[model samples]
Target: MSVELNHTIVHCRDNRESAEFLAHILGLSTGDEWGPFIPLVLANGVTLDFATIPAGSITVQHYAFLVSEAEFDTAFSRIEERGITYWADPHRKLPGRINHNDGGRGVYFPDPSGHGMELITRPYGGWPEGSPVVPGS
Candidate 1:
């Protein structure tokens, strides 16, 4: 059997708000509930389970997505259109600049819950020309 990532649980103060925030930024749909979670599943079939929690009880986490050059352009445009700030590095020091690491573009931002959201075109290693690079690969 092959192992694959199915979903991840995200604890938030407001599940709906957090789910909507992530869906809006990542260009996904929200408002869908599964059991006790408001899920925002991406095109890759990985669901971000937004679960509600008590007040002042949420820890920030980091999640990254690998996107294509075209998708990166579109998502980056959406990010700017939504007035969301982005940074080149994960440390968030180089604000408003996209990274050109591995000969592809990448940007890092934060979600409503202060979770680090990242979109990268290339992985740590480089990809050959003509190879399809899906978002959040």
Candidate 2:
């Protein structure tokens, strides 16, 4: 057997809302409620198990997804349709824009739970030697 990401718990003010938000944006489906969790499984089989908690008790988290260009286009359209604020940089210095970092498109936004969300078409380390480098790459 090899090591692989299986699942992770994400604390949200409303598990269902958070799960549904991400699912709708990514064009995925959520599993039936199990215990306190609302599961959203990724294409790679990694499930993000959303659980409800007090809003004040929830800690911020960051989740970055490497997506195909088509998936990015679809998800980005959904974000724009919802008027979600996005940035070209994770630090959020550049607003209302997406970065062509690593020779691919990337954007940073926030999830319903306030978790930092990122979508990129290319892995940071896969960038060509002369490609523009984004901070933290």
Candidate 3:
């Protein structure tokens, strides 16, 4: 009846490790391995199927997640605990810090596959007043 994003393939050096890394950071559960894929499904029902590929086969991709404030706190804590270097800017100009953009907190970090991963408490430009932005809508 309508278009939807079911899943996407993410090329990584190690599927299991990459999937687990993202799942843990985002506080999501890893799905059972299917064939060569290790999946991490989001709350919106979109699955990221991680697949092991040759080294240097994938170009760096950017993934941004709009999380709740509580989720952002938890994930940011984990990032600090693991000593993962982060930046306030996507260009990585401001190192060792998170940004407060659109009146919400956000941080950018790299996954094991070198993909840029971001977590923000607000959507870009912020959601309109008196309305909510549904994920995957």
Candidate 4:
């Protein structure tokens, strides 16, 4: 009855690697392999179908995920454990740090395919009253 995002194709150098990487970070499991895709379904019912493509042909994309504070803590620890470089801001001026924007925590990191992955505990517009609106945090 209403428009919804069902699935999206994420082009990566290796579908299985991309899918597994994201699954580990999100604490989720990937769906069974099908054709050229390795599906990673979200709690909201959206499926990210990773497909292997030529590295030169893949255009890195930015994917932002809004997670609970607990989830953020868990995922952020995994990021550090893996020694992944992260930034407090999207511009990446502050490396090895996270942002406290909108009264919540967030970090930006790159996926194996070079896609920009963002994890935030609060939506940008959900800032508390009297808090300054932060752009690109």
TM-score of each: 0.84, 0.91, 0.89, 0.90
lDDT of 3 at 40: 94
C-alpha RMSD of each candidate structure in angstroms = 5.9, 3.8, 6.5, 3.8
lDDT of 1 at 133: 29
Q: In model 3, which runs have C-alpha deviations exceeding 4 angstroms?
A: 126-137
Error of 4 at 4 (Å): 0.8
Sorted by TM-score, highest first, which candidate order results? Answer: 2, 4, 3, 1
Clashing residue pairs in candidate 4 are none
Model 1: weakest 10-residue lDDT segment is: 128-137
In terms of lDDT, which candidate is stronger, 3 or 4?
4
Locate the minimum summed-lDDT window of 10 residues in model 4. 128-137
For residues 36-123, write the lDDT of model 2, one tens digit per residue: 9999999999999999999999999999999999999999999999999998777777788887876788889999889999999988
Residue 67's C-alpha lDDT in candidate 3? 95
- TM match of model 1 to true structure: 0.84
lDDT per residue for candidate 3 within 3-112, as digits (tens), equals 99999999999999999999989999899999999999999999999999998798889999999999998998888889888887788867787877777777899999
**Cα-lDDT of candidate 3:** 0.85
